[model samples]
Target chain A: MVIFGIDLVLLISALMISATPVLLAAIGEAVVEKSGVLNLGVEGMMITGAVIGFIFAVNTQTPIYGFICAAIAGALLSVMFAVLTQYIMSNQVATGLGLTMVGLGLSALIGKPYEGIKSPTLSKIEIPILSDIPVLGPMIFSHDAIVYFSVILVATVAFVISKTRIGLVLRAVGENQEAAHALGYKVVRIRFLAIMFGGATAGIGGAYISLARVPQWTEGMTAGAGWIALALVVFASWKPWRVLLGAYLFGGITVLQLNLQAIGVAIPVEILSMSPYLVTIVVLVGISLFGHHTAPGSLARPFHASQ
Target chain B: MKFKSVLSGVLLAFGFGTVAFAADVKVGFVYVGPVGDYGWTYEHNEGRLAVEEHFGDRVETIYQESVAYGADAERVINTMAMQGADLIFTTSFGYMDPTISAAKKFPNVKFEHATGFKLADNVSTYSGRFYEGRAIQGHIAGKMTKTNKIGYIGSYPIPEVVRGINSAYLHAKKVNPDVEFNIIWIYTWFDPAKEADAAKALIDQGADVILQHTDSTAPQAAAQQAGNVISFGQASDMADYKPFPRVSSIIDDWAPYYIARTQAVLDGTWESTATWDGIGPGMVSIGEITDAVPADVKAEALAMRDAIANGTYHPFTGPIKKQDGSDWLAAGETADDGTLLGMKFYVEGLTGKVPE
Candidate 1:
């Protein structure tokens, strides 16, 4: 079936790929913000992950190893931000911005040698019976493993954040770190672990761009995707499920715009290009009107044990 | 802030002092995208390298890549001017206004912008006539394709890109009356993922031959993966995909122009002027036509290329009509540079409006 001259199956497929990376990065950032840490370096962490992930995948001939290295590289880079903001009590916003700069610069330096080199791409995991299902199979089950992993990761994060003992402690710390500390929870340590998780997930997101999406490494390939993920977190109102919806919404509009252009739409290309951001802003505004626009209590505030 | 400004003042003084010393000429380049893109910026970076190789120590060239083309571009250009750059090349269309403003700030520093119309006393606007190459590509795409449908992934609705789409469509329709052009305007200069997705969408709609204006090899790669498809490279020669999908490419050769401009600065012959060179002047080049193309088609394409080079043919010749069916070019009357430079409408027989 075709809608507005765009084929339904192809549109769904395009939406899945476009939304995967942004979803991965946003879900990771949602966790970071949930821990009372506002790490603005998601862009940085994602790009570094993309380069390192490409290098390893190309060398090891396996995307699994590449994603592992990407996560490690992203986590290591986030550690620097963690030390500055968590321990040294530097400004989170400034440090996060600096981390992004360092990430972009360092990734450019590291990725310089990998230019023009083609890395192996990840193939989709198709289940025989399920894949044969009309419409949904090709749209859902036909994507690479990372697409499934991102959804599962979001579900797992949502479950762990709401149902687990650790979830309670993380929520307590994010609500009021001093109170969590009084309850014998190590606020800084928990926040540190949360930040590292964010870095790793963001790395995987970046690796997804290099290893599967475009399946090649180019400098700054993340291309402001990290920023979009950051916005998605706020747009999702820090909920994992909401993050998934928001990412798909973003991906859908992006894919739809391209399809609209291909189908000979007479609207200006600039208007179509702005449709994704425009719809996103409108949705965010609608959510705000519904009074769900609140951030973590200590989102960007540095906590000191004695103070 | 006071201390920083004081320090900058001192540095500015020193920068001027170094310029006065003048033992070597320092040329700076501000690129809108990363040099690793293997497309527009990559070719410009190559031109910068050519400058270094040609002049050695007599000229020192430096560049900052991936600069955004708005306020950030203005600031970057200003910083380069303040750092005592003898001549700076701001290589992107969006850098036009910033380059002019920066040139106004530093009257001593010469500036050159790519694919822009605006110029100042110290600023020159230059671009390649890439449509000449597109005409050849159109001929090839017309001759090719078991599916009679060709796809074009446009970067923006700018006149330059519009000219290319028009040239390709006009020439393709000339060779094959049944051919159809599917154009997708992707409003970005260098996003590979978006470019690739556009390519896939086009191919899904039965486009067997693809053309792109964006700076990425992703579309070529997409065409390769989709087998039985043909594509052409843009900005740089992506010969890696040769013998199949990447049959030929439009190469942006900026080295000779760069070297000559630098030489002009050295000899005190530098003056702000507009330059729009094509295949004839070697600014726009067509990469190797591989054996994948049938001998007759290849010969015809090369002949068209040579004709453009020798000024025997024009891409936007008369007998063209606007998308509205209004007369744009009368038969046998070629388009002048002014109309082509400010082109904002699609030609007749092409679908969709060129977005304002």
Candidate 2:
């Protein structure tokens, strides 16, 4: 029942729940990078989603609407990044950093009135037959709908990236923008779509924090989850399945560290505090290296087509 | 975040540059967390607002929130002083050395650092004895908890937080011999999602009563979700949870001190001082006790609160041993301000060591 003085069931359940927000954001970032763009404003977009989702959820009293609007808000914010990089040819790094600053400021402004307000938290859904199982059922099947959605989203994204024609074109664009443009693949359009998808996913990820994880609205509540999600994309080597693995690994180590601390283990708190990031980087990056995974060639490079 | 702050600092310098000339005096506030946290920073902002309202056009107040400690804090304080702030309040314990260093640089400018011990000619320190109020919550929790487990969410390993934990645990153990404490050091002053996760982890670990020394209402939301758990509001009265989770709170009132200090600066009588007040001086007032607390427990809690306020009872009254079983306080003896301020060791029954 207990592993290392922690209830294994509770630890696993907490791990899944804790990882959902970051996993969702990472999935979106993975897509964005795979299309040869890096929008560092993931933090900005996330808080925008967090505040917008929280506002709508509180006003309408429907968390689903909150998620819907949050994605729109996130994508809409990311559209700034899309427009600048695609048409204006602004430097992606500076623009992405600006977007984060803008997002934090804008969210604080809009979220002022909604501070300390609780959202309509989603109830856990226990799968009918699976809930009857002993340990794994309770661990994996009893989280809110968002948790399950994130997992399925990862699988769907992985399938699309590896199997679909759309995936080939996006990868081609990331690998060599000029080539993809010469091939008449409409490189700008594909990257635009990818950035928007990333924004939408990151937005939903931000919403998860406000609507379920914290279940309350607070200024800067997304904190640095967006940044971690951004890092997660590179560490996972832009692979969707690997992003999920990285999230769970980070989440699991964190939960384990806290649980062990609660049980009076005398491990230095500083070492344990930094363990999740350390383990996540070591495991995910180590795997990516062995698999020969690397960043997109055109990532963060400004691209424009000449007639 | 640093970029954002730097940009705002420029904007603030320009905006307040004009107002400073017309104003009789300029005052500044430096906060460790966002002003909208609805907790510690919120209360301090309320004090800042009160100063603005009380002084009207004669005084001008400016503040920068969510400022990091160390170099960033020193920079913010230095910026305010350079921009002509006559008095500035740096409201975070981590900003002690920065406050001292900044004060040295700007001798005429008055600086007050909260919950810190260091002092200089121009820098003073002030804090409330929140541990006095924690005793009442401890008694109520000991009586209310069915699980005999109390989870304390501690922010950082500072003496202010450690003292609260020790005082609360000592009282709880006095009432319930079976009571056990689980302490989690989160290392952040305000991060809602992380705070929520910590609260959930504590609940899942069998804690039924929670107390948070951090500045956020996220823990209240977490306890509310757990349905049966009880919690005390921290730094600010999180009244939304009301009769259930947030039964009582220790509210920090800094307005009067801020006003008096500002007045002292204006009057040219400002001197370096250390002020530590508790319920006795009304700086740390206890929030209302909801009916959710059993009548007997509520009465007992209130009685303890009054005794503490009246100075007849001390939360750390004697016969206590250090976690290592060494003598800490002898029978009929109470903790001195010196020992309480630098508290680093846990009492005998606590399970964990004070992290460095």
Candidate 3:
């Protein structure tokens, strides 16, 4: 029984660690969606960041700089989708999907020489006395800087969206781009900036996986984490705090399922293994039932000047 | 006018006197997973490195990782041929048909598909008999498990994975008839999170011993976290987490085959042929048994290993029965390559069907 208690604590810690990547990705995606540009290629962006980050970290022996490079790479890749959907007036969903395929192929090509090599890992940041506080310290405060950054990002995004003028303008653009444009706002510019911001965050999130979480880059390491982030945007009802909540909830489910198995609970392994996906589906269904808010009015709908 | 005629004469002479560039031997590799996966593909890449190191000046190698098994494989191989690949190695069972089709298209190029039996004159096959190692691990699992129920985390329901599960089960049941095997097909080869979940699920089902064919450290980590549970490393020397696993492992050593094949290419003796080596040829190696295993069990495992190496004892010998109580092999008759290659069902003790 005592072992089970310890297992729960360890499970929670694992959940927090797993949640960092998703939180980083979801937050970046939230900002993108909030600015009225739908980049469904978050998975592609993340994987691109993962390979580039891994290669750079391996070559430079500095994981931090690798993350920076990853962010830049992600933003650059996002530019293709930005150009296609924004300038070329292509369908957002199709363009994003195409971007994903391109990102996957390009990463596979560039990542050839880097196969099987381990990259530098990010160092954990312990908050001195806070890290010594029994189970809570190791579970929360003892994570790497990126994990802390994700938490801070949640607070900062919430604050920015609720309190700042830029937030209002961004919201205005998302809600009704034509109205925002009519009101002397540069709607396209705002959305582009927001899209870049999302790309940068997604890149960092990917770097976190390669540099910290798994601490190695494998093909498709993101493994649909980007899709999860996309789902999280809807799960959170397009709200910042809710996105954090949703990411943690999913993260917790993932960790808890593993923990339950670790503790030697008497259940069918297949059932236990399938629980996380089941929980995700159930939560999504529950959210859809109760949370009835529509998506951003300008979401996925390109705003051409002619229109 | 004389200067123009002289220039023209010089251009014509130079054109006629042009020297031909020597063509490099073009080698291509198709990987099932990203090369960065520190297991199967990683080992294969190491072999590629060995090839490069041996014939650096004469051979040029190009490879694509994370290639799928279907139509995409055909496209990648065609693309490589178009790009001037003379010999291509498609390293996955699913790559069999694609390699065959591509071989037909590119008759000038040699194609080697791993773990597959389908052959064209230009398309050959190669794989290690990993079931030998699993037999030893199954013996250990039979000895070590406090609970008679053992869990297996399988990748895809292919013959390769099926062979491992059957071998492990056969050995386990030989030691302890009460042993029951439960399998969880994760349907993926390298998702750590999924693998971890699968390991955990096995533990939840009261399985004190676990074995996996997936490519990741997640299973080992999950087994470690489970404290009393034990597991063997898949596709690599994962003895790093020893004592907990404690007994045996099946390590894939692709370096020798890769080096030999590349040397053959460099020496102009390279031929398309199926190559499958077991423990005898050093293709399959067992990691050091940890101190945690009981001495008697260790001795038994070593004896079995020696028997396998010396070919005195066959792991899949006669008198084995299928799940339906049908005799799989007659007494004193070793299971032949045809039966083993097409093995699709479990021997009586397993509790699950081969997932379709």
Instruction: Write down the C-alpha DockQ for each prediction.
Output: 0.63, 0.68, 0.20
Model 3: per-residue Cα lDDT at residue B83:
90
Model 1 lDDT at residue A25: 84
* lDDT tens digits by residue: candidate 2, B1-356: 99999999999998898656677889999999888888999999999999999989889999998899789999999999999999999999999999999989999888999999998888899999999988988899999999999999999999999999999999999999899999888888988888888888889888999999888899999999999999998888888888788999999999999999988888899999999999999899999999999999999999999999999999999999999999999999999999999999899999978889
Q: Report per-candidate TM-score of chain A alone.
A: 0.97, 0.97, 0.94
Give me the runs in candidate 1 sitting further than 4 Å from their true place: B1-23
Candidate 3 lDDT over residue span A1-307, tens digit each: 1365335555666677788777888898898898888899998998899889889999999988898899999999888888788788899999888877887778777887765455666777999999998878876788878888889999999889879999999999999999998898988788888888888888888888767666655667787788888988988878888899888888887666555544445666567557767877787788888877678888888987667
Q: Which of 2 and 3 is the better model by TM-score? A: 2
Q: Model 2 residue B163 lDDT? A: 95
- Candidate 2: give the clashing pairs: none
TM-score for predicted model 2 compared with the true structure? 0.95
**Model 1, position A113: C-alpha lDDT score:** 81
Better of 1 and 2 by lDDT: 2
The model with the greater TM-score, 1 or 3, is: 1
Query: How far does residue A275 in candidate 3 sit from its true spot (Å)?
Result: 9.9
TM-score of each: 0.95, 0.95, 0.73
The 10-residue segment with the lowest total lDDT in model 2 chain B: B17-26
User: Candidate 3, residue A189: CA error in Å?
Assistant: 6.7
**Candidate 1: pairs in clash:** B318-B333, B319-B330
What are the per-model numbers of colliding residue pairs?
Answer: 2, 0, 1
Candidate 2: what lDDT? 0.90
